[model samples]
Each structure stands twice: as structure tokens, then as C-alpha cells.
Target: MKALVLAGGSGTRLRPITHTSAKQLVPVANKPVLFYGLESIAAAGIREVGIVVGHSAEEIQSAVGAGDAFGLDTTYIRQEAPLGLAHAVLVSRDFLQDEDFVMYLGDNFIVGGITGLVDEFRRARPDAGILLTRVADPSAFGVAELGTTGRVCRLEEKPEQPRSDLALVGVYLFSPAVHRAVRAIKPSQRGELEITHALQWLIDEGYEVRSTVIDGYWKDTGNVSDMLEVNRTVLESLEPAVRGSVDTASQIIGRVRIEEGARVTGSRIVGPAIVGAGTVITHSYVGPYTSIAAGCRLLDSEIEYSIVLSGSAIQGVRRVEASLIGRNVDVTPAPAVPAAHRLVLGDHSKVQISA
Candidate 1:
């Protein structure tokens, strides 16, 4: 079996950051989000993979060159536009020719991995298999309505009136029979050929369609809040280690990993946090669920539940929480002035102010 990982899209939901970087490449616990999916595919014993990339093809290729790091032989298939999920499968025809493959959305996070799902699919070999999870907001995702025998009966793409709370997770398994379905479906009202439509086609054509409702953690890290939540969830299982230098004046609490070359002095760091390599934290309070990336500096600052990217510096900031700082950015306290507010936000930016 092969894998098709979709890493292309205009990530408008994660503005400003996605404006400059690929959404799939955004780091969770100092590692790119897409890396987790690729590793899972490798673990599932899928040796050959095809990555669907768009405008950020060069960057994705640079990071995942030859797929040697992930134990898979990767082929890059270019998608000239950010079409729908079905369109991605349509474009990957040559690479996925007549092969049963798994389609993974690169920016999606599934905690337990897809090994079990892959095994299940191998056993049943259904014409189409989709993973479903109960979500609070079914309208935000493609939802599925199951039939009497627990088969998928109907599928809707972000329906206004959802029939069920079971939202489609980003992982899907399909046999070569899906090629006919993709070709038979028409573009949705949104001007794209949605995968949900293609699955519905398969069901209408009397093909077996399977659905599994996963109870494990799954998230599509498309927005900042979701990203931070996923980061915090992953940190809960952190194993503590300190390969870096911590001065006697510093206090390291539970489950924190300090990478090599990082130095901590006169500071206190709480549990389930990570200090990346070559970072320096002095006279600061690093609280739980915080990930400071490599080459960063935190001085006289207090941070918790936040992700600071590489080469960024946060100095003299009293406190920061639930924030995602981009790479190579500098954050410092403003000079003393009258009480006022200042913010230069980008598109879709969300801010909260204490009253």
C-alpha cells in the first residue's frame, strides 16, 4: 500500500503565520506537524509515499527531501491549485495508479497514529474507509451519517444542518475503485470536488463503505487555538530529561526536557515543558505546556501554555499565555507610558484584553 499526504492549501484560517510558512510545517513540540503523519505512515509499513504539494512545494521538498528521514521513498506531485481533497486524488492518478492508498491531511493530528486503522483496512479491504470522531461542532467538518449495518450511508461536506455529530477525521483509506468515484463526482457548490462527495458516490454505486468512530484524540491544527491545544495535549506525555546546562540558581520542575546547548539560569521551569537546543532562559518563569524552540532567548519573562518559535526573543515581558510566537520575531515590553492599548494584528488575528 502507498500513502498520499496532502500538504497543500492556502491556510487562511492560520493567517499571518500561514502567510509566510506552510501550515503543515508549523511546529508542535518543536517538531513540524506534518512529520508526525509521515512517521505514522512509515510505522504502518507503507514504503512508497506521494506528497501532494502546492505553492509551498519547494519548502516541503527541502524539509522532507527523498523521505530518507521517515523511512519511505517519497515522490512529489505538484498541484497547481489548492483544489478540494478529491481533486488531490485526481491529480495523484499516476503515482497512486491501481494501488490501495491512504490519504492523510498533513496538518491534521491524530494522537494514537494510524497503524491500527491501516491494519483494519488491510483485513477488510473495503472500497472506502473513513475515520470518524464525535465533535462538538459537526458543521465545521465533513460529517457522516451511518446506515443500519453500520456502513456509511450519507456524507456531507460542512453541512449547515448536520445529521450527526460524527465528523470525518483527516485519515482515509481507499482502494483503486475510488478512481471511478472521483471521476464520476462533480464539483460541489464551493467550486471544488470535495472528497465527501466522492465517498457518497461510492456508496450510491453499491460499493462497500466502512466507517470507524475513533475515541482517541484528533485535531486539525488549522488555527492558533487548535494548534496550542494540540501542543498542550502532546506535552502531557512528555518524558523529562536535561541534557543542557542549568545553573544552581535555577529550579527545574517535573517532566521538562532541556535539549543540549540550552542554558537556564536564575529561573524556574514547570513540568511538561521543553527548552529547545541553543536556547537561553534567564530570570524567567517557564510554566507548564510551554515549548521554546531552538536559538531562542527568554529573559525576565514569564510564559505558560505558549509556543515560541526558533530565533525569537522574549525579554522583559511580564507574562504571556496561550500564544503562538512566530520564528525570528522579537518581543519586548513597551516603554513606560500612559495606560493605553496598542496592537498591530494581521488578518483573522484574535486578541483578548483584561478589563
Candidate 2:
């Protein structure tokens, strides 16, 4: 079986950040979110892979060349526009051929990988197997309804009133039988061919559809909050390693990894944090769940539960928390200025000032 990784969605929720960069390329623990999906696919023993990219296709192509970096043979398919998930599969038909394949969303993070699911799919060979997880807000995701025999009976994408909380995780396993299902379905009211609709078509037909309810951690890192959460989750598993220089005045607390060339001095860094290569942390407080990317500088500031991208600097800032600072950003305190209370006084207007 091959793999079709969808890396093309326009991440509207990520706003100004997505305006400059692809959401899938956002770093979680200093690693691109898309890389995790690619690595998971590679681990699942799927060597031949096709990545459907749009908007930031060049960047994606450059980052993942022949897929040799991930030990897989990759082909990049360009989608002129991100119409929908089903549309991606439609465009990638040539690359996918008549083989069974796994479709993975690049920005989604699923802990424990998909190796077990892939093994199960290869054994049973269902027409389509979707990974599901119970979510608090099912309305935000594609939800599935289970039948009497524990099979998927119905699927809905972002329903107003969901029948179940079983959300469709971003990983899908499909055989060549889905080709006909895609052709049989019409575009939804949104003018895009949703993958949920394609799966519903298979249900309408006499095809076997399966579902696996994942108990492990899974997150669709679409918005900034989720991205930060995933970063924190990944950082929690890091082992303490100091390849860089830590001055005697510096105090490095638990489970922190200081990459080579990074320097820490006169500062205190709490656990489950990472200081990337060439990053400098001086006279600052690097709190837990913070990731300082390569070539960054943190001086006289306090940061926690945040991700500072490569080449960024947090200098003289009082505090920053739960933030996703982009690359090359300089976050410094504004110059001090004299403060005064000024008011435009009109006739019969009274103003009180405390000296």
C-alpha cells in the first residue's frame, strides 16, 4: 500500500501566521508538524507516497524532496486550489493507481503512530478504514455513527447536531474501491467534494467500511492553540540531554534538552523544554513546555508554554506565555517614555488629575 499525505489546505484559522507560512510546516518541538505524519507513514511500511500540496507547494517540495529523508519514495502532486479532501484524492488518482493507500493530513498529530492501524488494514483489507476518536466537540470534525455490528453506518462532516462524538481523525485507509465511490458522489452544498461524502457513498453502496476508535492522543493542529498544545505534549516526552554550554550560574531543571551550540547562562530553565541548536538563553527564565528554536536569543525575559521559532529573539520583554512566535521576529519592550494624562477640555467640562 502507498500513502497520500494531504498538505494543501488553506489554514484560515491560523491567520497571519498562515498568511506567511503553511500551517503544516509549523514547528512542534522544533520539528515541522508535517514531518511527523511523513515519519509515521514511513514507519507504517508504506514506501511509495504522494503528497498533495497547494498554496505553499514550493516550500513543501523543498522541505520534502524525494522523501528519501523519511525513507520513502515521494511524489509531489500540485493541486491548483484546495477544493476538498475528496478532490485531493481525485487529483492524485494517477499517482495512487489501483493500489490501496493511506490518506493522512499533514497537520494532524497522532501519538503512538499508525503502525498498528496499518497492520490491521493489511490483514483485513477493508474497502475503507477510518480512524476515529472521541472528541469533546464533535461538531468541529467529521463524525461517524456506529452500527449494531460496530461498523460505520453514517458519516457527517462538521454537522450542526452530531449523532455521535466519534470524530474522524485525519488518518484514513482506503482500497482502490474508493475510486468508484469518489466518482459516484456529487459535490456538497459547499461546492467541494468532501471525503466524508465519498465515504457515505461507499456506505450507500454495498461496500464494507470499518472504523478504529483511537485511545491515544490525536490533535488536528489547525489553530495556534492546538499547535501549542501539541508542542507541549511532544516536549513532555523529551529526555534530558545537554549537548550545549550551560554556565555555572544557570540552573537547568528537569527533562530539558539543550542542543549543540546552544548556550545558557545566568538563567533558570524548567523541565520539559528544549533549547535548539545555536540558541542563547541568558538572564532569562525559560519555563516549562517552552521550545526555543535554532538561532534564537532570549535575554532578560520570562517565557513559558510557548514556541519561539528559528532566528527569533525575545529581549527585555517582561513575560510571554502560550504564544507562537514566528521566525525572525524581534520581540522587545518598547522604549520608555514619559506618561501624562491629556484630555481635550470643552466648555463646562471638568477633569480631575491626581499628582
Number of the top-ranking candidate, with TM-score as the measure: 2
lDDT of 2 by residue, 100-156 (tens): 999999999999999999999999999999999999999999999999999899999
TM-scores of the models, in the given order?
0.95, 0.96
Q: After superposition, how far is residue 31 of candidate 2 from its true place, in Å?
A: 0.4
Clashing pairs in 1: none
Q: Which tens-of-lDDT digit does each residue in 1-355 have in candidate 1?
A: 9999999987899889888899999998999999999999999999999999999999999999999999999999999998799999999999999999999999999998999999999999999999999999999999999888888899999999999999999999999999999899999998899999999999999999899999999999999999999999989999899999999999999999999999999999998999999999999999999999999999999999999999999999988999999999999999888888989999998899998
Candidate 1 Cα errors over 4 Å, as ranges: 338-355
Mind sharing the TM-score for model 1? 0.95
Give lDDT: candidate 1, residue 116.
94
lDDT of 1 at 302: 98
- The residue ranges of model 2 lying beyond 4 angstroms of the native Cα positions read 341-355
